[model samples]
Target: MNNPTKEEIGRILKSSKRIAVVGLSDQPHRTSYMVSKAMQDAGYEVIPVNPTIDEALGVKAVASLKDIKEPVDIVNVFRRSEFLPEVAEEFLEIDAPVFWAQQGIYHEEAKRLIEENDKVAIMDLCIKVAHAMTKTH
Candidate 1:
């Protein structure tokens, strides 16, 4: 998997404030839940996108990215790598500026699609780590 340059990661972390956490879980033990919570604590507004849940982290969750009427700065994904193509398709329909696959996930085609669409594509990077990295400097 191709890693985003540090500069690119910094840019994404700096510019994105409203993150749509795709496949975010309601259970606090899950990685998605933990990361989203950390992000919320870090001052980024997290919008949970999960079809099975009605809410997460005190915010009402939407069934899909398409359901979010507000602008999403970044689409932070927690789904498996196999689902990225579908996720990319949904992202294409929205005005999101960045596509972020979580720490253990990456999909080449999806990355290609997101980059070709003039959006930033970041894979296999923990959003919390990236955010912290930016804060240090």
Candidate 2:
């Protein structure tokens, strides 16, 4: 995937109101928790999706992306690269505008699947880091 420009990242962060954070963590030490927090702090609604916990970062947690009925503008992933295919599969079915795989979590085959749909934006980038840069500008 090509590196997203700050302008592009800013537009996505500013425009995407509701985000589904997949593989979100129950523990504070995890990158999932940190990244999710960053998104929330940046003014995005983050629906935590973790089967092990019912809640995280004070937001109601759903077991999976399919469980959330509300509109999701972006589905940010924090899972392992090998597990990305499954997450991508589930996210593609949703009506979300974007499918974002976080840093170190790209699956070429999976990315191809998500991008095949012209309606959705398949991006490989860190949501939190993107927010930081966007905010800086």
Candidate 3:
């Protein structure tokens, strides 16, 4: 689904503590960098997943989700919609609970694939915004 209900969003945010950020950039100007930084500052453990970068925001970067050894609560994707299918495949491999596409990023196929596997798929929403909203509760 393109838009998740408030309860579902809250549940995901409340349950998730460790986030894997795919396509995260080291640059401060990038949205991924800013969002992940905010998440880290919020006390969530943020793991950086980016092949091109060695690290992001002082966290070690893994090339892919498959490389992550620890349990990942949320897979926050910063990649474009066109790349989500590949990201979705990785999510399935890792059996991630939540697959979140950042603001302005959405793919029906990816969403369908994730939801079909009974995982929560959040699209076109910012993780920082969701987390901030959930914190108010």
Candidate 4:
């Protein structure tokens, strides 16, 4: 799969303000919660997009990407690789510019769809790590 260069990824992190975290959990022990909490600490607005949860990190959660009425800069996914294609399909219906699948999650079809639509497709990478690396100068 084609991945963004460090510079390009850095730019994406720097420019993005709002993140729609699909599959984010309300439980603090979950990796999704920890990483998303870190993003919020770093000044990015983390919008939880999970049908099961009511809220996470103080922000009210939306049932899905379609439920988020405001603009989203990045759609950061926490689901498994097998579920990516479906998320990618839903992502296409949104106005977001970036499709990011968290670490250990990657799907060729999902990546292709996102890139084919002219949006940034990032997979098998940790957004928190990217943000930290980029801020290190």
Ten residues in sequence with the least summed lDDT for candidate 2: 116-125
Arranged by TM-score with the best first, the candidates are: 4, 3, 1, 2
Q: Which has the greatest lDDT?
A: 4
Tens digits of lDDT, candidate 4, 1-137: 76899999998888889999999999999999999999999999999999998999999999999999999999999999999999999999999999999999999988998899999999999999998988922
What clash pairs does model 3 have? none
lDDT of 1 by residue, 73-116 (tens): 99999999999999999999999988999998999999999989
Please give the distance, in angstroms, between residue 62's alpha carbon in candidate 2 and its true position after superposition.
0.8
All candidates' TM-scores?
Answer: 0.95, 0.90, 0.95, 0.97
Compare candidates 1 and 4 on lDDT and give the better one: 4
lDDT of 3 by residue, 27-83 (tens): 999899999999999888999999999998888999999999999999999998999
Best to worst by lDDT, what's the order?
4, 1, 3, 2
Give lDDT per model, in order: 0.91, 0.81, 0.90, 0.94
On residues 76-95, what C-alpha lDDT tens digit does candidate 2 reach at each position?
A: 88888898789878887788
Cα lDDT over the full model 3:
0.90
lDDT, model 1, position 94: 98
